[model samples]
Structures are given as structure tokens and as C-alpha cells.
Target: MSLFLGTHQNRLDVKGRVSVPASFRSALRKEQTKENHSLIFRPSHKMPCIEVWPLSIFSELTNSLDSLNLFSEEHDDIATTLYAEAWPIDPDREGRILLPDILKEHANLTDSVTFMGLGTIFQIWEPIAAIERCKAARHKVQQKTLAVPPKATKKGVEL
Candidate 1:
């Protein structure tokens, strides 16, 4: 129900807590019961970032991953990395979640952080890392767009 999408940069407090952006918090509330809204955090395999998911979404993702053959090398690697890094957490009364210290260190998170909403899940990034990543991504998109020009349409077409 919480179809979140977009990026928001925020700061973490001294206690290792980050306030869920207003839009993301509202979206998460829509997906879970009022009394039991939960969140999980884990290190991202692709980057120096953390992945955050609602309890419901996390369960759904884990269930899908469960169908994989755990004996296979690929599955074993994924399982070990994901499970070893995962941390289940819930927000405090003030609507902030405590990020694990190890995870924070993994991402090199210091005073500033970036929260990027990606539909079913979200990512936490160190501000500098996030900026560089975004720049690189934008450049790739630009190159692709330039490589393939938009098709011309008839004047009467509704599109």
C-alpha cells in the first residue's frame, strides 16, 4: 500500500537514529497496522548503503528468496551476505529508528545521510557517496538517452 518512490536526504542524530522522512513514514503507516509498524535494515550488496524495508515487504522478499536452492553457491553467497547483515528494527515513540552501529560504519555514515525511496524498499547512503552515485547514474541515463533518440510521432497522434 505504501508505494514509495523518490529520494530524500536527511541527517542522523548522535544516538544513531534517523527520522523517517514524512512521505516515507506516511507510506509505511498505510501498509501496516497502526500498532505494529516495523522496519528492517541491512547492508546493501551493490553499494556502501543500507536497505530498509517494512516488515510486510521484508517477509514477502524473504519468502521469495526462500524458494532458491540454498545448496547452490549463488544462493549460499546471497544468504550469507543478507542474513549476516540484516537487522530488524522498530521506530521509537518519536518515529525514529536506531541504525545499528556496524551498519552505520559499513556505509561510512557520519553526520549526514541520504534516504532514497525505491518503491517497495528504501536505501540509506552516506551523503557524499549518494551524491556521487546519483551523478554517475544521471550521466548513464543521459548517455543512453542520447544514443537512442525519441521517435517522431504524427501530428494527429494523441500520444
Candidate 2:
């Protein structure tokens, strides 16, 4: 997998379209198998940012839904949560996507937007908020509050 790794800042155009960083576009190009190149955008449940997922990654994410009981409330709720606010977006020829109004409002995005790479997924955040988030993440690391998990064995048990 081509991991998204870096921070990029771009201006949102008057039409609310923002150009995706070239590296991210390339990563998506490598991952997409379908003719229509697209991404999934949604308001992150836990954060004040827009979650950006390449189509393939989004599919893999939703696959977890298969584990839930069919037609059960738990399954319905999860499915609704995942699909309700999610929007599929195709970048224009210039590699720009029109930000949905809801997502823009959720992230408090104004003129400038920051694109943050988080390996499997990326996030669109307001520039200042992105900087603060980065600072907080660094602090957590310094405080030893976050660490890599143990590697999993073939049996799927952590070692």
C-alpha cells in the first residue's frame, strides 16, 4: 500500500473546491481499480475534521459491517452511522474536490485548509486546528501516552 505521509496546505477556492496534494493523488491512483477515481469524505465522529478515505480503503473499512448480525439494530445503527454522512467525490481534472457544505461546516474550514496524512486515511482540517492537533499528538508521544501495539502472529494474536 502507498501510505499517505506528509502535511500539505492548500487554499479553498471560491467554489469551495480544494486541490488535493499531488502525493495523495498519486497514492489514490495506485490504489484505485475502477475507472472512476474517487474518494469518500465524511465528518469524523471524534474529531473536528473531515475524514478522507480512498475508495478502496473505504470499502475495506465498511467490510467490518459484515461481522454484525443482519437486520439487527446494532447492525442497522452501525451501517447508518457509516453510510449516512459519507459522500463519494471524484476529483476534477485538476485534482480538486468540491467540499460539501456539511463537511466544511463540521471542520470549521474557511479560506485555508490543511491536509494531514494519517497512513491509511487523510484528514482535511482548518489550518490552525491542524497545527494544534499536531502539537497535541506530539505531546502525547512525549508523555508516553501512545505507543505501537505488539505485532500480531499468524494466528492473529498479539505477541
Candidate 3:
């Protein structure tokens, strides 16, 4: 699997289009979808950021719903949460995707956006908010004294 890594910042144009990082585009291309430029944009459930997922990954992500009882409220809630916010997108030849007004508003996006790589996924954040989130994450780590877990050996657990 191609993992998205590093931080990239891009300018949002008047028409709400932003260029995806070259590295990210390369990573996404490796997914080998039928439509090369196809992508999906959705507001992140956690932070004030938009998430970019290739169609293949997005389809696989929805597979988890299979384990849920079809008639349950929990299933309905999760479905609504995921499907309701999803928007299909296609990057133009310049490797730019249009940030729809709804998602842009949800992420509180400004003139510039920060793409924070999260391994199998990536997030688009407002530059200031991304910086603030980083600071808070670091502070949270420093505030906690975490106990390290035992490492797993090839044959068994290791302390």
C-alpha cells in the first residue's frame, strides 16, 4: 500500500481549487483505479480537516459496515456519517481538485491549506489550525507519562 507522508501546503484559488502535492498524487496513482484522476473528499470526523481518499480505499473503508446489523441505528448513524459527507472528485491535468464550498466551510479553510499525511489517508487542514493541532498534540504527549508496551518477538511477546 502506498502511504501518504510529510506535510505539504498549497494555496486555494478563488475558484476553490488547490493543487495536490506531487508525492501524494504519485501515491494515489498507485491505487490503479479505472479512472486515474478519480478521488473523494470528505470532512474528517475528528479534526477540522478534509480527508482525501482514492475511490478504491473509500470502497474498502465502507466494507466495515458489513459487520454491523443492517437494521440497527448504529449502522444507520455510521452510514450517514460516512456517506453523507463524501463527495466524488476528479483532479484536473494540473493535479488540482476543487474544494467544494460545503467541505471548505466545514474545515474552516482559508487562503492556504495544509495536507497532513496520515499513512493510508491524508488530511487537508487550514494552516493555522494544523499548527495549533500539532502544538496541542505535542503538549498532550508531554503531559502524559505513558507506559511502554512490550514488543512482540517473531515467535512470541518480548518485554
- Best by lDDT, which number? 2
Q: Report the CA-based lDDT of candidate 2 relative to the real structure.
A: 0.91
What TM-score does each of the candidates earn? Answer: 0.81, 0.90, 0.86
- Quality of model 1 by C-alpha lDDT: 0.83
Considering summed lDDT, which 10 consecutive residues are worst modelled in model 1? 146-155
Question: lDDT by residue for model 3 over 1-159, one digit each (tens)?
Answer: 799998999999988899999999999888766755467789988888899887777878899899999999999999998999899898898999898899999999979999989888889999999899888977887889554456746326454
The reply for model 2, stretches above 4 Å from the true place, is: 150-159
For residue 144, model 1's alpha carbon misses the true position, in angstroms, by 2.5
Model 2 residue pairs with clashes? none
Query: Using alpha carbons, what is the TM-score of model 1?
Result: 0.81
Candidates sorted by lDDT, best first: 2, 3, 1
Error of 1 at 103 (Å): 0.8
RMSD to native, candidate 1? 6.3
Question: Least accurate stretch of 10 residues (summed lDDT) in model 3?
Answer: 146-155
